[model samples]
Target: MKSPQALGLALIAALALSACQDKAAAPEDIRPVRYIVAGGQAEIGGDSYAGEIRARNETQLAFRVAGKVAAKLVNNGERVKKGQPLARLDPSDYQLDLAAKQAQLAAAESDLAQQQLNLKRYRELLAKQFISQAQVDAQQNGVNAAQAKLKQARAALDASRNQTGYATLAADADGVVSQVQAEPGLVVAAGQPVAKLSQDGPREVAIQVPENALDAVRRAGGFRVTLWKGGAPLEGKLRELSADADPATRTYPARIALSGDSRSLQLGMTAAVALPARASGELKLPLTAILDLQGKHYVWTVDDKTLRVSRKPVEVASIDSDGASIASGARAGDKIVTAGVHLLREGQRVKLLGQ
Candidate 1:
């Protein structure tokens, strides 16, 4: 047998040899992705905004009278039509108040009748010389006062009945209930928001865009907005751009008007607005094709007919519905690497997938 020191050196040498073999087994070149250079007229030159699909009319539904919510008939996200009852409040208190008003009105009418009778008696006494004319006038004045009170009481009863109607919440316009704030048996104050309704109207794409994008949007150019839903893209027109940036976000809100079946679109749907009008000679590619190495965005470029691939840093101009519009650092005649970019390093050799 060998000495103890020699045996230890042999074991270390064997491990080193195995590591070298494993390294040799790995591929030297990274396979690059092939791209088709189809030179067609691209219509992506517009102010692309990153926005969401939002309802045009969003109204807050509320109760007119202060009462406990007795029954909430509609659930959140339910569709409601005009004049439809969405919620009911406890009307017991209002009912009792109306009844009291009715009783008061009745009492006022009875008093008016008694005053009329008294006035008639006074008139007869004055005519028979048993009472003075002034006494008759005073009784007639009392009758007049009672009549006025009865009229006022009647109006009060009518007003109380109107208040009772407030216990039932009605939808003033057609819309979808975006949010339900009132719950069954919850007491809410008058004019308090019970639900948020998104009215049925033209949809808009609201996006928070950077301040630099504001100038481009105001230049009055044809912009395109795309809604990605269920793998099918819905196109829209960039209708309005904000005049100023939001104070809190430091970004401008760009709105896009959606067309055709806006009813199917709901609020807060993720959307992409492509603003590639400012981009000149930039290639539009999928966001997945981008890579980040040391905080820099890169993409893999493949060599034709060879298994080797190269990594290149691309300047992303803007990202919208289609993908990222590359402004610089990539060209139409270039081959990009897509697979395994995160694991790739500079000067790494890769093989094309089908080569």
Candidate 2:
């Protein structure tokens, strides 16, 4: 019903109204974030390290001679006393060797006796001037050679007897059989472990500690071990510490000797070792505060008066549950944005909540 000029004017008015509404609905440019002042150092309880129970004197019992295993005298977990027989090899070969050496010795003895009789007869003949001196001297030489052969044979017999005795493997100390490596009818070589014996003595807890915590562990005046099952804490002392770090884990292997009664502890039990963790002189920030820009690490630090955020480049020493420990680029009293860091731009204004 309106004319062309009137319709155009109305359309312009509507457009102006929509533009005003859009301006009113525009989002705020400043962002709100939560941050923590980095000054107060974090409190850390003793570092927990996982370890296993072991024996101080774990021994491996092996055979001294190569042969087929004829008998296994003890089973796994069996208690044994010193000099107890744990396994035996087939003695047939060793016994036959001994018999052969004995026979050779007896023959040598008989030869020596005959040669002595000949020497005596030669001496008598020479005294009567019935035989030449050279003939008598030859008989004496034969007697001396026969006696040397007898001595050599006797020495070989002793060695053969020792070999026969070696066929039986015996425990060197009081222990409990923890493992069996061979069985009856299985052939084993000399020095091959047939069983593992855990000697009945001091108990040890073996653990691998990170290189960073090694110095703190060494300086710890005392130690305590608690079972993973939540048993009473057992007093402990460092028994052995490895000088070299493990190549794969980059950790040092150490052992703690348990004091008092360790009868409740079992082999292969999981344990947690509590060691004092002092301030490592590193600033720990929340993991959310760290932002990776390219290959470098960054965080948003809030200004005290301006309430503006500035991007801070920080070097992280270690990352754990507490957060990332900063090695540099951040000081003890700096304020770092913990949340909504990605949405913030450098030099942008921000409102600190609970300020």
Give the number of the best model, judged by TM-score.
Answer: 2
Candidate 2 per-residue lDDT over residues 1-355, each given as its tens digit: 8999999999999999999999999976788888887745343346778899998999888898999999999999898999999989999999999999999999999999999999899899999999999999899899999999999999999999999999999998997899987799999999998899988877889999887777778888667799987868988888888999999988999998999977556788999888755464557788988998888999898899999899989998988765888888988778888897878898999998832
Task: Write the residue-wise lDDT of candidate 1 on 1-355 in tens digits.
Answer: 7899999999999999999999999865543443333112242345445677788777888899998999988988898999899999999999999999999999999999999999988988988999999999888899999999999999999999999998999888998888887889799999999988888888878878786556565564444556666546566666766777789988877676666777777678877876545444557766666896677888777655654556777788887655677777777766565445677666656654531
Write down the TM-score of every candidate.
0.60, 0.68
lDDT of 2 at 61: 81
Off by over 4 Å in 2: 1-47, 131-137, 209-224, 235-254, 259-264, 280-355
**What local distance difference test score does each model get?**
0.75, 0.87
Q: Which stretches of candidate 1 lie over 4 Å from their true place?
A: 1-47, 209-212, 219-222, 230-254, 259-261, 275-355
Worst 10 residues of 2 by lDDT: 38-47
Against the true structure, whose lDDT is highest?
Answer: 2
